[model samples]
Target chain A: MGRVVVDVMPKPEILDPQGKAVAGSLPRLGFGQFVGVRQGKRFELEVEGDVTQEHLDAAREAGVQVLSNPVIEDVVAVYADTAAVQA
Target chain B: MGRVVVDVMPKPEILDPQGKAVAGSLPRLGFGQFVGVRQGKRFELEVEGDVTQEHLDAAREAGVQVLSNPVIEDVVAVYADTAAVQA
Candidate 1:
């Protein structure tokens, strides 16, 4: 099986009130020196085949289309294990 | 100023109860074909310097040390814009 990791984050120019709220709460959470924090989504998928660059690309496209908003967010893809490809 | 985006997610083998809850709620939220979803943290930092690879690396290190559990999660760093470095 293959694993895909996607990260979704708000666009830089846009205001992220949620992020600001989190940043504000950090000190209360005992986290210091963390000037700011933005909240995003991560996804893990277990596909039925070996992990390949093509599979990664297709999964990423699907993620952007269905799970993320392109206008105010960005998605990134990461492979869990490259061994499947090498094997 | 340069912007850094960090994405943190739970490791694959670990159980992501929060992610499962989010995934379970997606259909009710009117999102379909999204078999699963995981939650994570994204960080955007406006560092007071050109965003060199060194800067990115340093920020990533700091993030891992403070915000993430290395045993159960992973972090990624992305550049917002490369124009400043080219100029």
Candidate 2:
């Protein structure tokens, strides 16, 4: 089994009202030092068979084409076993 | 600064067309053993200041209220420094 992680974010130029609202609320959330809070979405999937680059690419393409709006969003696909540890 | 990760998934009862399509592509990605690929969305936010439970709670609430469709999706909020490592 393999796992895939997809992250979707609004275009940098786009006005993320949701992000802004969340950023504004950070102070209230006890993150008093936080001045900005940008929010995005994450998706996780478990593949039933062997994991391959082609599968990852196709899955990512599908994400860009159907799961998100290219005009307003950007996506990143990460294959769990091969993904670099986050910094 | 603090980071918040929000994962958004379509409700199990709802049809996740994008996820299904992505799942279908996994075989090509080299994940032949994978039979199911449920896709979700991930969002990462970098707070400019301190991080607190209240900030986390508020951020999570905002995500649920405005960032996602409650009827069609579910969300999970994780505070980076305190988040339990995924198994």
Clash count, one per candidate = 0, 36
State the lDDT of candidate 1 residue by residue for A3-75, as single tens digits: 5666667766668987787567655655444466666676665545655676566557655775578998877
Error of 1 at A53 (Å): 6.6
- Mind giving the per-residue lDDT tens digits that candidate 2 earns over A1-87? 565666677766778887787667656655454455455556565555555777677557656865569999877444454433221
Cα RMSDs, all models = 5.8, 7.5
* Native A-B contacts reproduced, model 1: 0.41
Q: Give the clashing residue pairs of candidate 1, or none.
A: none
Lowest summed-lDDT stretch of 10 residues in model 2 chain A? A78-87
Residue A52, candidate 1: how far off, in angstroms? 5.0
lDDT of 1 by residue, B11-83 (tens): 7667888778767765665544445556667666555555567656656765677557999987744545443
Give residue B30's lDDT in candidate 1 (0 to 100): 51
- Candidate lDDT (C-alpha), each: 0.62, 0.62
